[model samples]
Target: MGTSVGPSAGLSPKYQRLIQRTLRIERQPKLELQNERQQKKNTKSLVSDLDGKLSSLQSQLSTLTDTTSSPFDGRNASAAEGTEGFSVSADETASTGSYSLAVNRLASEDGRVSQTFDADKSNLSDFFTNNGAQTFSVDVSTPTDSNPDARTSIDVTVDSDGTNNKEVLSDIQSAIDSAFQSAVDDGTLSADQRPSASVINPTSGTARLSLRSQQTGYQGRLSFSDSSNNLLSELQVNADQIADDTQGGEITEVGTDEASSKLTSEFELNGLTFTRNSNEVTDAVDGVTMNLEEANGTASSFEVTADEEGAQSVVKNFVDRVNEVITFLNEKTNVNPENGERGELADDSTFRRLSRQLRTDATRPVEGQPEGLNTLADIGIEANRDGTLKLTDEDALRTAVRENQGALKDLFAGPDGVATRMKERVDQYADTGGLLDSRQDSIDSSIDRIDDRINGLDERLQRREQQLREQYAEVESTIRSLASQQQSISQRLF
Candidate 1:
């Protein structure tokens, strides 16, 4: 049979598919490079996590080594029955012992108030001293302290129509409060030591003004006077009314006056007499700051003891941090058997060495412990099958700390200790110019090269496509020409 060819017949489909398949094959290396870059990124992130754990452990270890924060040197104070008002805090230098404490009295400040007046009716302006003087002064007695000036006298000037308006009782109170408030804002007077004023029985014509001490002790008593005015007399403030009040006296014409008198605080500590300007006693006992609340007929006492719970908490934290890093490393360096999925760092020899070193350091004995308890297991921390650690017995750990405090501090903070070695190990991978950084850089470079090669392949494929299209068109033209010639010959023969 004679064969007839269709005009629509074109280049073979397999030929077109051949180059596309080659392009896919060419892209395989780039895809691999992208995946490797991702893996390196994951490894770097895990390294940072491990570094943080190491840093935390180091910080915790510092608490045990520092002379100011050592748990072995820590002490806690407890108030006995009826002694709850006073609380205490101690540092590492605090000596451990029990002492009987008594709150004989708390410190206090001086307070004073002016005599009442009928603002609308009484002629209160006539109370001023002889020479139209409207100023007054207060004498304060706090045990003279070197710093803070403990200003002995405060000057209060009346705010009025400048000697024209008739001043009332409330006007004087406002002026006094204004002066004290200014002192407080200037930092000269402490908030607790600042004076306050209030109007008692306000509506009554016989309303009285009262003042009390801000500091709770006797040294805080206050007395009032005016160099040439009757300000103190009008306010009914006298030395006897304030319990321990004293004021300047013998004011000469435009000259100075006598010095003010002050008082002190008295109390008993453990039947030993102690005196202080203020009721808060700090130096009486080492590392103990006692704030006396009140005097009681029955004596109150408290005790100081070693803090075992604090020490145990520190050790437990150490164990958990160790387990966290170890477990993370193990997970990152291992392949899941069920899924057969390899981890990012599964075949990395450097990470493998690090993982193995981590295991050894955690379980191995440290070189510097004097009691031969060099390993974490000696302090009740032990590793499990899955590379995690647990506190096997908490009591045993506490006993180790209390019995061997010096040894524990040396064991963790010493030259060849677990924390020191682990810190160095983390630095190898996580620090700048470390292995992890270099590995990331290498992967990044490979990915960049893969991208460049991909672009090059695209350009090459475009050129090949252009050449193939031209050759196909030529072949088609020849086939069409041969068919036309055949058709002409057949028609003539017929």
Candidate 2:
């Protein structure tokens, strides 16, 4: 047998694989395209990070710029140690002052209990539904007599099918609650003036109806009258159980005489006494709300001061956010001097420009600020050598917040101020359709283009590979035929 020179003559599986491998070498070089894509992905990631930092910095600045809610305008109220009977708080409008406070009484809600009835045996529905009368009305009057006619009335309808005392009492309670809630929803009754009814059923004993006013103190006194039925009379809760419903159909008293003291809050501020119908008193002092928890005869000192710590915290947070943006830009835009290694964004001029703008705005003096309160440096927020902020002198910041808060706020949050300008600049990059978005879109488009080019190159390479396979097959067949003719001639000559 003679050796054949066809493509399959020595083309074992291993040899065929080698040929295929060699053909793959002729395919397009995608290393550069792949590297470019990776670089673009990295840039996009960095840009996203930059966008996030800028957005955070802008949000921190917004808080400072809002005059109505500026942290610098905040106030704090502090009561002297060992002070009794009260807790107090102050808002931005509170005056910074010291005053003596004394609480004589804490206001309470008005409540009344009906006569007891058998829990399971007594049937209240029969009494209430007499003469087909199944409806009742309740009135809640104002604490002051200035407007005697100023009262709210709610009508309750009883459920007729209730069988026992407890069931009937529960139905009446539900009806009353529904009526009052409906009045509130319909704007006929104020929520504070709405009364409540409950069926008080004790275990192994009798049941009773409990009527209470939601409003604290005298304002919460309740009165009952027959509308379509004598529901209150049936329960024995009317006619001076607490007090007779008089004074033009409004009950002036609903609780026992001893409980009357709890109907109004009494306190003294700066030796001047005051009384109110609520334990939480907001009108005694401007911008100050005091909660009288209990009554103590002794007076105690309370101080209202500027919330320097709160303002400091806001300032510190702003500074920290600013530093984060600055630091991120610095690191990404930095180039190592020793190794000449470039950062992710070192070649981008936009980030470098933003970094400079942020640093300049943070450190620059304001246009209209007074000399003593001109710059952040004056308030102890100073720039480090690397353009980051540091709270160098916390005491200085506190003093500024304590004494010159308005000017300090103006320095950072005022119109054309540091935070205002920085925020405006950041918005150009961080907002939708802004610089970062545009840059991201451009990078994505470039990546798409590269992918398209790679795909085209691959298609061309696949076609070329197929052509080479056909050409190699033809060459192998010619070689095998020539070798066969040479073998026949050699054998005939032998």
Candidate 3:
């Protein structure tokens, strides 16, 4: 029942060698696993970059295809040909301009006077009020026959102190000037637009500030009040009368042809008066009503409506967008960046083919049209010597757009449009079953296999490490037994 002494006292050299060999095997697999993991990471990164590039190219190609097939530029030949029967002249009604507006200032229920101008009828009170209460009031009006110089007065009263008063007045003046300038800038008003406001005083007082219209016939009155309905009433004299008295008509151009003509012409919108000779046209019998010049020719009878202008602008923008897309694609594929390299998709045969295809698709002829109307060239979009398209004849293009609008819309906007075709092509190359998709699939599969292999290697390495430890422990025990046996034999011999 007693425990016997073992011959092995310590680990033998043979057992140590066996343990070392097992450890070497275990470490070998771990090193291999590390290398495999690094390789996997590098491979994944490479695949990811490639995938991104592929996706980008696919998107670009899709966009190009869509644009190429889009109805934006595509027109039905028959529709284009039909447009030849109609003619549009720039001198026609399209060239004529007219605006109608009504302006008036009324005392609000609270005794605050509010002014409104134009069709939408914007209230000047909004510009000068807070919470629907006027903080200050301005009176710009021309005097009656009793006060010939009354038009020269514009009384501004500031209920608030500090820069707010000055700022508000300045803003009002600016707004008035801007309104007049806008008409001139848009070519709707002549340079002789008669009214111009002049600030008399910039400080707070009775008639603290005033604006005088440049013309004598411009006799309009305005009144200002605060939110509390308190009136800061002031009188303004006719500027012409004032000038005649002070400078003997030297500053007054009332009788001149320019002034007279300006006075006679008024802006009307939908039969409503908007402005007359640069002054807000009003219904009051006090002011003279001016007549517009009659159109001189039959062509002048035709009018270019807002809708027509909008359509023309839309077409132009579409063409510009197409040109931009073409330029972008060309630069990406053909031109090298400043760094002396092309895009990822550069030098790709597919991209080159796609570009050519897009061009071809864009320029393809439609059926059922006259020879001249078969291609974009008939409508004035001609191919340049450099292979790009340009609008050589704007009139022809416009006519085509007007006459064959439906056909043109179909060609570019229909299901078979250049944009649609381009999108299909790009999607084919970039989709799950596309060229890039196949490559990605292969790479993914390889990654999966590699991962599985690494996993197996990991498990094998762990098992081998554990086995080595166990073997080393056993070897140490055997050596201890051997040493004990040797010691007992030695003692017995002695």
TM-score of each: 0.77, 0.81, 0.36
Q: Per-residue CA lDDT of candidate 2, range 287-401, in tens? A: 9999888797679989999999899889889988988999999999999999999889999999888899888988888999999778888888889988999999899989987
Candidate 2: lDDT of 405? 79
Q: Over 4 Å off in model 2, which ranges?
A: 1-28, 113-136, 141-150, 156-210, 226-262
- Order by TM-score, highest first: 2, 1, 3
Model 2 Cα RMSD, 1 decimal: 6.1
Error of 1 at 78 (Å): 1.8
> Which prediction has more favorable lDDT, 1 or 2?
2
Task: For each candidate in the order shown, give its overall lDDT on alpha carbons.
Answer: 0.62, 0.78, 0.43
Which candidate number has the best lDDT? 2
Q: After superposition, how far is residue 183 of candidate 1 from its true place, in Å?
A: 4.0
Ranking by lDDT: 2, 1, 3
Q: Which ten contiguous residues of candidate 2 have the minimum total lDDT?
A: 243-252
Compose the digit string of candidate 3's lDDT tens values, residues 265-327: 333334543333333223422222222233221111112322334445554544454455455
lDDT of 2 at 417: 88
Report the lDDT of model 3 for residue 186. 74
Judge candidate 1 against the unseen true structure and give its global Cα lDDT, from 0 to 1: 0.62
